[model samples]
Target: MEVKGRVSNSTGTIVQSEDEIDLRRGPWTVDEDLALINYIANHGEGRWNSLARSAGLKRTGKSCRLRWLNYLRPDVRRGNITLEEQLLILELHGRWGNRWSKIAQYLPGRTDNEIKNYWRTRVQKHAKQLKCDVNSKQFKDAMRYLWMPRLVERIQAAAATATAGSPTASASATTTITNNNNTTYNYNNNLNNSFEVHSGNMMLSPAIMNNNFGGSQSYTPENSSTGASSDSFGTQVSPVSELTQDYYNNVTVVNSNNNNNPNPDYYPQVQDQLSFLDCITSPSGLFSQQLDFQSMEPNTPWIQSNGDTYNGFWNVENMLLFQQLTDNM
Candidate 1:
């Protein structure tokens, strides 16, 4: 099955004949995708260089590998990133920074490239709007105190909505949670791990968090100063079922400039307005050590309003607050 071509050796021996392979480039065609898929399906993966040659694909090993992993793989999840995923990404990035591959490992079906793209396109876009370095203390604090908490709230709200939408599904999930000895339920099957429910509080397995999140020790309620079930973030947190309707109805942004008047428009509608960042300073040791909440101005313009179209990450409150603050500056 070998294709032979002219060959010569310095020793005047034509021991073997080989031809230089003309590797294909650019976007892969359907035929190439099918070829790669079929080859991998039959022979399994690995040995990419030889696999490419054996499969008769004109593409290079690296290109084939990227295509398979990023797109053609059977279990590769697609479409928009979910609220749960967004939360996990923020948590993981907070822990690991730009270790995209490491972060991708925890997020099932998500490729490192996809995660990197999301960070660059969505997360960093918001960071740029904030007019601060992504790595800066102010930005990180804004993420931890404002952005991450809003994500948690949205996750809780979404879970609540899903439960309310289907009584049968909710009942089944409840039954599964109750019967399981480990007290873990993976509501989002797209994720690699399970969510632990204990006394109506959603608990992430310290093992899952520590192992995939690049830590050795488990994060527990005991770790939180507030003595509530907490994630790695050290904030007092709870599950969806435990949070009351008032919790959903009440998210306020106080105007630091105008006698701390509560912004009436700040109530986040779970379906639309779920993401925002405020200038509120955090005392949590989870943020940077050098960050002094006392020294910073009350109405710092953390964001610039360019009238970007509203994505799930940016909402009216964020823009309004930013615009107001920008005016003051």
Candidate 2:
């Protein structure tokens, strides 16, 4: 086809620029496809204008690029998305929203267009099969249940950060809070049950450390009744007192009274405890909460916990406590 075109700048004046004036067309051949793919894989996508020139392809940069991506790419898996792939697409789309590219990341060899189409067709089909409206209140409710734990974890993490006073406090508190929140949120939202005892223990370490630091100055007894009260409260608050002593011992200046200090051994004990806590509370430790205990499906072993199976009152109370602790952290 002999195509005629005029090129102009913003002012509507006919510009004689060679870059704008030149136009090319024709069916892409094997040689063109090979050239385009080789150039792209080496140099990477984008800069389409330069691609046509440097790659020595007669086709326009747009056509060469589109052909390569939509058909000629080696990784492009050309087939219908299988049932397994469809489920993955639905789950990923539910979690990530309209992040088609990210969804593609999970489905190797699948194009964005393929995933998008599969979602539109298969999501609706499955929704109808389940006798539910894809855009209805129930569908949204289902999605909420699906993604709630992740959302809750993020909220708790933010709360922890806002309440944190020092870098160590902030880092340690945020991690602990997030871990606990993830456990609690997943258990409550998925399994519809109260999480195991470990949730409380997660908060115990950070709480103890904070309390110890806050009470450290009151370690010595004074003649005043106020001083006596302070010492009583300070000693009684072992967890908090231990944390404060550890913090001060790590950072505080040593003085003439250091040798005579009543709690000279306190800091080392707290430090040891902190190390023990750190060893156990690794990032992977959170995954245990995600185990689907009631799973019956052999291939897809993770079953979503139904709300009807657990006590509503306890769930509400636990969620409230989680929110409150997160807020005050």
Candidate 3:
């Protein structure tokens, strides 16, 4: 039987180098594996040209070795590694460094590629958590506990400029301008006090200020008018009362919805019990009727009740859940 297979090597007229040879390309089957293994066993695994000739196999030595190690090796564990393997890779890389191939050797099923990917992902995740850009100066400062003093001065100058234009700038505008002129003195004083309080352990980097205070905070009129003025220091200041009132009103609406149901148990345990009482009392007292029905006939009403009861129950539950979530906010 003249069974023909794809020719492993092109029979070229020119005797060219190995690089010039075109090996056969196809999926390896059990027959191919057996032939390759037998060839390796007989030849003792060296000299690709001689092995290919003697074994009647078409693959190069490098290809043969890759196939054997990746697929046929007895110790090569298959399938994906678990979360435990991922953590091990992180810890090992942190301690021993980025020797991925070496790390893969320890992880029976893990590939070097997998380890490298995991490391890259973990680094990105940590960088995000720290609120520092991996490519920015803040990230470098975080990694090395040091920052350019000139950069700090630039940040201070920017802060002074922002303070001058702030709403509070009207009240202590003169003091603020004077402070801006004498920023070096005030900065030194503040830095000294902060250093004393933290015992030099907590160095307030520009990164921390940028991350925490760069965004909006509770704006007090005294602070707003005294923009960058030391005179407002130690003064009683509350965030804009209007903002707080609006927040509370929104909370009240959510709370009202939560307590409208007859079934108080549906509401969150942390919900203000007093607000739940008010909700049940308000809105034409519908929940009162539901409460009466629930108490008088439990199992009988459960079957006979229309869709109204269920809808009201769920609506109230949803409102209560929203309130519970908002209360923390």
Q: Which number leads on TM-score? A: 1
For residues 49-86, what per-residue lDDT tens digits would candidate 1 score against the true structure?
88999999876688789887877654444545554466
lDDT minimum window of 10 residues, candidate 3: 295-304
TM-score, one value per model:
0.52, 0.36, 0.30
TM-score of 3: 0.30
lDDT (tens digit, per residue) of candidate 3 on 1-329: 12223334466444545542455445555555666655554445657556665666566666666565555432233333332243344334543567887666445434576667765675445446545554454443322221112222233333445445545323211221122223212112222122122211111222222233342422322232122322222221112211222222332212233222211221223221122122234444323322321122111121113322212222343334334433444
lDDT of each: 0.47, 0.39, 0.36
> Considering every candidate listed, which one attains the maximal lDDT?
1
Q: Distance from true position, residue 305, model 2, in Å?
A: 31
Question: Which portions of model 1 miss their true places by more than 4 Å?
Answer: 1-20, 170-329
lDDT of 2 by residue, 236-294 (tens): 22222222223233433233342322222212222212221221234433212342212
Clashes of 1: 0
True-structure lDDT of candidate 1: 0.47
